[model samples]
Target chain A: MNYVLENIPERALKPREKGLTMVMDKGLSLREVEDVLETSGDYIDIVKLGWATSYVYPKLEEKIKIYKDAGISVYFGGTLFEAFVVRNQFDDYRRVLDKFGLELAEVSDGSLEMPHDIKCQYIRQLSEQVTVLSEVGSKDAEKIIPPYKWIQLMTDELSAGAWKVIGEARESGNVGLFRSSGEVRTGLVDEILTQIPYEKIIWEAPQKAQQVWFIKLMGSNVNLGNIAPNEVIPLETIRLGLRGDTFDHFLNNEWK
Target chain B: MNYVLENIPERALKPREKGLTMVMDKGLSLREVEDVLETSGDYIDIVKLGWATSYVYPKLEEKIKIYKDAGISVYFGGTLFEAFVVRNQFDDYRRVLDKFGLELAEVSDGSLEMPHDIKCQYIRQLSEQVTVLSEVGSKDAEKIIPPYKWIQLMTDELSAGAWKVIGEARESGNVGLFRSSGEVRTGLVDEILTQIPYEKIIWEAPQKAQQVWFIKLMGSNVNLGNIAPNEVIPLETIRLGLRGDTFDHFLNNEWK
Candidate 1:
């Protein structure tokens, strides 16, 4: 960034809508959060307290405050929502969100089974209080939702007041949206994109190869989520074709 | 660490003769280094600025100071040594170590072809300048060294004055000591231990499953290298058998 390079694709600025980068905070210490903010805060849009780590991560409020103070949105991972919902504590979950002063919430059934209508209802209800990001895939590798089901679920969630539909791949990037071998379900993604706008979805791409695949497919401004804190700079480089993987992808790209 | 847990194996404290944890710093900002030291300093014995990253990583002096201040030894990655040696800048490399106030150095032939005797001679020279950690193995996954050869190399490196001989896995944990799939070459490791003392060899096990494999095989006191910055806590938990992977391994472990 200190030196300008020709042929580098333009990346969307912070507060990005289409080229959003949502990072996964898997129990980072306060100092670590400070370091992340200092180093890669501008590149990051949202920070998800990955899975149920927020439930056990000490100083959750402080960590969230760090992100929020940096003008970055912070939300608990979708699994926490399911954890509360499965325990019949939806109200408590809302109150917990309020307690954390969060302006965003995730609705997901990645780890639990819920009726589609009920899932939509929860999305609609949370949308009133905070921006909702409803995840549309199951975490179980054995449970493969077809492309049609994915499109239907994403469309329904968006209609249910969800701001964005998250494509689940878990933190490992090896389930939902990706095969167990970490290969992208190319056909399923291509099918889902037919119905769901790329801007209304955040693909969980924790691996560099997957990030490259998505960038090649969706250009520099694709919405990506579940990125590790350390990878923000590397991902930005990939997006702008500064890294080897996408160095040639953006030479003549006009996807800014 | 805040609370005592039953069935936890006794882990050797720092300044330890064994149970060494060598972390890999692949271009962390100075603030990030502070966070790592604050969070996992006690568990980390040495940190390698991963694979020539120190060449481009800004504020190299300050970053090393942070680790040194925390009573932890820091060394440039073995690949950097290969880079310097290949360029015939061996003396310049030695000067750089002194300039950075590094008390440790690594000698490795992972990235290039070097006669075993010549590699040992470099190790002998570096051993006089600083504590040398000579790595043995090919970075090329296809260049397989038999189990006996692994032992021979490791034994010769240790004999040549390396404080510890590191088994190559190249951060990805998919070469050298491990298979391309990141599985430990159990037979190779078993063979190596037959001739080389496990205490003198630092197995590069960066992956969790690989870490679990080593912990189970060598008990809680295995010397592990190339650990990611964030995995230090998880690795410590595995060593203590507090994590699920080795929860039962050390529950009745007599080796601890």
Candidate 2:
């Protein structure tokens, strides 16, 4: 099924390096997951079982199979990893991932406070076993790390063998790069972008306005995470410049 | 399966009144709708097929059957009625509703410029045939009617035999009794409440914060509309004082 907006640029299909869209699965049923993939599968590259929701869903295996069948990479949210780490069940976590056929893993100290060296070590260790994605920044707004520290953390994680470093924005786009009003802190985004390689980072932008801001600032190829399942088509429209937000940005651009 | 907060302010199950939660369905698949209903079916009173999406979805009968099986009332959005009225196919729209087993309908003049008398006439006409819910405000924020006019519209619609009058907030909470920041325009809400019966109004609040504000300002039994399918449980939690926002509010009181 060809999407209506096929003329726009930077919309690489599956196995894409640029314009990657990651969806957040917050306790969707197996059939719901299948229906989502059937309708908007082409636009999604990765699916993150959001926060601690993976522990709640009864039929996790069935849900994983549905996503796998649709050629979408599935991974647990960073908070889930923090839960495992806090419980001292990292080995058990790896075993569960292997059993469930999950190829990707997120390593972050979003909830649980962990030292930078320890965080980097896990990133390196996980990279040897599976594709590792490490996240920077705390979930709590009060404990927000400076932009320089975030850039440094991104560098350390990438060096330690993380496939991509994620900037935490949580489920609500109120904290981390965003203010209480959901607007991106422009200076913070600029400072982080100046130090970090944009290609190796996936920014957690859960809102439409946030997605539009990032796409406008970093181009359509900017990797985005925590997208709602239903918003996949709308996000794709924004990425391809079909949506009003980024239409002018890519209208005259050429696709590789 | 019993939910975690089952004991909290036990709402009337399916086919309910008073504490009604009407979800806005904007082109969701059959499986997606079923998944949402499975988890939060008990809380949902009505599901509005948002805007013109009902006319666009494939296998409309199958979708309606799924909602009916879950014991939920399915209705088309008011915009569809306006569309039908524009095309001079009101009879055809009624026949389609009967064919699809839809029991509820919305009569509104949000999109088109219909006279107040004509709108009230349609509400009376629709009330005779089906469960008619008349909406009071326009979709465009710039074209919003004053508080006095809204109160008059609500009173007129209810007098014309409509079940409930819904205030237009569109999908985004911004623009109608809500500021550009999605905060409730307190002055406007207060003015409208003074003129209209609280029991007769169903405020369309699509955002979680907006839902929280309504539950906090107007008690647990406040009627709300345009809720997302997944948010049904969360909204119920807030209404019942199970979530942190309301838990802090009601737990300190004698209600706990």
Candidate 3:
């Protein structure tokens, strides 16, 4: 693509396996979806319906179609899955995904204390027909799991037929991999990266500063998730070093 | 209007003088405007085309028309006013507003150091034609003005016939009325409220915490500005104490 400026950091094209941008759709109208797609559709990879919000949003099928037709993968938020599993209605939940003709799904136990093996069983079961993105880590900021435990769970989830394992930061970016104040836990992140492939874990970075930190550490191709809808273009700019925050780092790179 | 739940802490009906919500629009297309108005039009009082972004935004007139049709007033951001003033194109700026059929305009010296008398003169001049919302305080957070100076400028600007004097926090909630970290300058805000009516000043509160602080301190009817477009519904929830942040504070008030 011929952009106005030259020497911009390269961005991964659609159908990309890396530099993924997963936006959390709390709830948006069909027209809103069209507008977003018209503007920044190319930059988006997956659009996850946030939490159990999909259950309350109107016109779920039409909205899902709007996203899928744009080549963006659509999935129910893991909270919605947990909500179903807690009620012992996993079959009913599968039927709902079928009703929407969804090809992607998320399996998570962020809101529940399900056994690790049981969670992996669900991931393995769903992987037969859909692309499963299983999330590791608790949603509660106080529920700090050891870094080794996070690595172990993620490794098992990936081996259990999961397409990618998501690091749970919640939509606020203030839990799991981050502190209650939304600051990323440096040692925990560093430890996880040592054992896991960076390309396989999508970091939930819902804030600008958090996005900057990840991009600076892993460059433009790092997979990031839990992005708010309106921030897509801004995040893409940050990725390409168009914004002032990351301008000097890329422009002054000694080895271009 | 009919709502899912009644007894929402009474929101001041629009065309209202207080409890005003001014959202910052940083170049959204017309369809996006329609979707937002369809979902949360009643919650918005005014839409400020953010910074000088309008200069580059396509279909500005159509977007402005959409906003006005929704009964939400439209004004070029104060940065645009400063842009025109710096280039000595205030007449051209007036012409642009007239051509757009705008009834509201912003007068600000946040970017340039125009004499206070001259800034007030623009307010006085524009007030004869359009309702002026003059902004006080510099956009640079480090250029701190003493509390007494903040009070004097706000009071003088209001007397000069500004419909409302905007406390200049910019859209980031990191300058003017706030510290670099988005913390409110408590003494300055308190002193300003002492001299100027809370209803006559719109505090630029772009962050959720800032919105909470204003609502909890000034009560629900405090006018707020520089709110993000997507945040309109959330802000209304905050205003009505529907959200957890301020639920107990207003719900348990004796008035309810």
* Top lDDT hit: 1
lDDT of 1 by residue, A154-252 (tens): 999999999999999998999999999999999999998887889999999999889999999999999999999988866776786544356445553
Q: What tens-digit string does per-residue lDDT give for candidate 3 at A119-218? A: 9999999988789999998987778999999999999999999999999898888999899988988899899999999999999999888998999988
Interface RMSD after interface superposition, model 2: 9.2
Query: Model 3 over residues B74-127: C-alpha lDDT tens digits?
Result: 997776676556556678788888888989999987766678899899999999
- For each candidate in turn, the interface RMSD (Å) is 10.0, 9.2, 9.5
Let me know the DockQ for model 3.
0.07
Predicted structure 3, TM vs. truth: 0.63
Q: Taking the tens digit of each residue's C-alpha lDDT, what string does model 2 give over A124-220?
A: 8888889999998776667767778887888889999999988888778887778877889888889988888787889999999999999999887
TM-score of 2: 0.61
Candidate 3 residue B80 Cα shift, in angstroms, is: 13
Model 2 lDDT per residue over B13-41, tens place: 44567778989989888767877876667
* Candidate 1 colliding pairs: none
Q: Whole-model Cα lDDT per candidate? A: 0.85, 0.80, 0.85
True contacts kept of each: 0.05, 0.04, 0.04
Off by over 4 Å in 2: A1-23, A32-48, A51-167, A172-174, A179-256, B1-12, B29-40, B52-58, B83-100, B112-118, B172-175, B179-183, B195-199, B219-221, B229-256
Q: How many angstroms is residue B154 displaced in model 3 relative to the true structure, after the best TM-score fit?
A: 16
DockQ numbers for every candidate? 0.07, 0.06, 0.07
